[model samples]
Target: MKNDRAPFPRREPSQVTGQRARPQEVLGLFATVITVVVLAVMILAPVARAATSSFVFVGRGNGHGVGMSQWGAWYAAREESKTFAEILAFYYPGTTLQAVKDPDTVLKVRISSTPWKSNTTSFSQVDLKPTVASGTLRKYASNSDSDFTTQTISAGVLVRVQNSGGKVRVTVDDTSVGTFARVDLVPGGSGASEGRNNVQLKTTGGTTVDYREYWGTMRVQPGDDSGELWVYNFVALEKYVRSIAEVDYDWATIGGAAYAPEAVKAQAVASRTYAVAKDGATLADNWADQCYRGYSFEAKYPGIAQAAAATAGQILTYQGEPVTAFFSGHSGGYTTVSAWSGDTALPYLVAKPDPWSLGAPPASMHSQGPGWNWTYTISADNLSKKVNGSLKDTSGRTVNVGRISSVDIVSRDTSDATSHAKTLRLTGAEGTATVSVLSFRSLIGTSNLPSTLILSVNGDVGTGGTDDPGSGGDPGTGGDPGGSGGGPLLPGEFYDVGAGHLYHDQISRVVVAELMGGYEDGLFKPEGTVTRAQFAKIAVSLHNLMNAGDKILVVNVTTKPFDDVAIDSKTTGDTSDWIAAAKKAGLISGTSSSSFSPFVEIQRDQMATMIC
Candidate 1:
């Protein structure tokens, strides 16, 4: 009989006298117990194992990756012996290289304006005088409300203008000439019409010189706000473009070698094209439009001026119109669509492979541009801090989110022959959110994670120690699997929530309330000052988003509420509609009874009160 229970009971020992069991029965019991123990171990081992908790981010590129890559152009020109036209053609495919009809056309750039700084009730005086080396100077004023009249003035004559109690006072040669809201200065021979004018004045050395020799016209006007003066320079387009190129591009020797002249020419054309595409009503003298340092910049960088002259009148045109030429410091290994860079899609502004970025000699050779290939390491704690901020939507609405845990690249676009992450998945302790790759880059710090072209993400979730290094390969040829011909990803549809800001909480709250939105470049710019026009747009958007009332009609309005709010007014544009609507709703009042002071800068407290 089988004795199951001896020392270790396997079976009930046949209900016999257990003390008298044979050694064989005890052995049988031991064997059966060992078998059961082995089976138990096999079933429980897998359940006790550990899980993976880390990830890393491997990426490439440095900018929005749209249009031309400065480094790539340099490489093509230096290594491949390509011309500027060839480089432009490669980057802006299907676009025509054309020449401007009037290269000497003037650009109205607001260089120094105090209006955006104050809206107080104080007053100030601004003195403007035109001087020429050999030509006579003249003052042009609006004869009728719709026509201009001219009056000859002596060269080097002082014209004093003052803004007091929301009215303008004008005086010439210390005598009261007239008081007008606006005035223009022209050469003696030039007509009163708004056009290019010249002046000549004697210098300290007693030498007469042309006004263009010193730069161009200097127009002074009443400040949009109190105690301020708005000064502008009506500069020739070529000169303006040259000034920008000198400041933005590095003309210094690199690795004991000079930058390719073709690259400089390419930049000149691109910059000129961008300027031409703008409406030219009021271009900023800085990067808001493009860096313009006046005659000082042109005098400093003679090489930049030469490049501009070489590409004089040349611009990239699409279907008979100037195309919006976009460029950046480096493309990493690929270029992206204009839409990826907060711009609308165009036939010419498409992404393409950039082999020059990879084929060029290493950074040690001094051929590679800055940010060509980069790396960044971020810890989990820091990442959490970055994600718990607010991002504004396209509709000017803000969305505040919580701490971030994991980041995943979901969808990609390869329509431009290069792979770039279009959509990003951000997981937080509270919930998960999805955003455009561009928006994510902005929130994460554009310098930290420069571009949307990613390779991998590796690390422990929510616990830091992630490495984001640029990938290595031939930038021109490598293709990411399943990363081409994808549908366009709209950036305005997503929000950029992150940390490292002073007004993070307030901005996040306002964005969530749908009262304000981020710039197209994907920055909330919490510390940036807002103009009256900008505030008007925000107010109107807020009222509409919150469905405040039907009192304000933002639709087609034949009449303007303020003199400065008219369609043809200096500060007029899309904001005019919003200003009109807000005025009709009694949500906003003018600086004076008739003057809206649309260009004045609004303080933070003022914005808050207006919103409330």
Candidate 2:
């Protein structure tokens, strides 16, 4: 059955075995969509299944299918005797390798972060731009000059930092050291057993408080609202590269055992370059960024340190600047971009063939097995739970599309030879949804699906209740895209939008609510971008919609906070009062103190922040 996707979980066919519904009836929110939609495929943010016992998904590769494929590189190095520079040249085409101008750059690698107890969404923090959410951000600790307190710490003292009474407190030897905004722990005394890089860091999560060593200063910083702290390892660039243990160093020993140091060296360069690229941004010390194990990982395989030193300062540069070198565990056969990062701006990060990942690995390749290919079978009931549990709508709420019926591979990425599956359509009793393979993988564990590079699917699902249920379905809620039942009818001159139009119902809702209106020509340009002034009026209307008696008055005022606004504030379409009122309500802002830029089209982020 054909499914026109509406933000991930699309509504079931609008007709159910015993009822009819709308897209909002299924997913409960309005959002722009991702992924391709075909007769067999679609995309989503939510799901569930009921008709079948289980569907077995067999897939290949691991990690996001973008940038370098580790197995591909390893095979090239081990079999083709490709040099590190040559390997890098092939994987990161159109990039020049340059020596480091500064080898000691410090990277703020977040080694540990506290969990959000109430957050059950499937998407990880890495999916968002700003990784750390700041809570009541306060001024510096009264006794310290900076938000992070470290210089005054006693030499070799064991420190435990935790949130206390909304203030972060540091304790040493079971005695309260002080309450501050942040704490820096220096593992000294016997704790510094593995030299500078091998100092162990004990965490509170484990029952016995297990520790991991790092090669730099460990800073514990408090988060916004939670009692949790984000621990970072402020390590130097070279040392940080040496500390990465993404893959074992033993891959250097091939069948011939002829100095094949290229693979590990290439990894060092890639890892270093990625860190340098993300120098200012928050980075997790895991695969979410790069697997940085610090001193402990370094100690386990000393060869990695040698490899890092050998490729010291070497980085992949595109147009003279270091590129955000992304690398994955394996590519089924080719690498493609994940939608989270736009591909247009990053020309180097595109889909390309990688014939190497398909071949057998060398005996010395370690855990990278041909056995990496995997199959996982999950029951329909569990599939529903897992999908419904994590697939969050754009509003960041979970909408259950009761018990899934059928799943179809709708589209594939035609950019490269791998032609990885791009979208999946899921049908359920409550509704139907189509979601990107990337997002769907999150609904089901990545460990289960591995990558979107599906070799084949070997299972079946019952037919969804697409057949019309007895009687017309229940009316949709506020989220209904169809503006039916109780709502003011649009003027007859509004000929553009009719019952069959895509946004006919949605347009009806806003028009009926009186938040917006048709143009002079009786046309509602639903697809057009909204201007700042236009949005201002909408914002004011929104405030008034919620506050019936107390509406924001739009009056004529020559003197206002902004000088660029027209003198006659209340003239029809003048926008001055709307701007003033929205700004007064703290729902909008101008380009600057004097300029409203009222004619400028509003950006997406601006709308998000104002709505938030």
Best by lDDT: 2
Worst ten-residue run, lDDT, model 1? 1-10
TM-score of each: 0.53, 0.54
Q: Runs in model 1 with CA error above 4 Å? A: 1-60, 102-104, 112-162, 167-179, 183-214, 246-256, 279-281, 338-344, 359-371, 376-382, 392-401, 415-418, 454-612
Per-candidate count of clashing residue pairs (backbone under 3 Å) = 26, 22
User: TM-score of predicted model 1?
Assistant: 0.53
Model 1, range 252-284, lDDT digits (tens) per residue? 233335457787788889888888887466776
lDDT accuracy of residue 39 in candidate 2: 8
Best by TM-score: 2
What is the RMSD of candidate 1? 29.9
Lowest summed lDDT window (length 10), candidate 2: 1-10
- State in Å the error of residue 70, model 1: 1.8
Model 2 ranges off by over 4 Å: 1-54, 113-179, 185-206, 223-227, 252-260, 343-345, 360-371, 379-405, 415-417, 427-432, 459-612
Model 1: lDDT to the true structure: 0.53
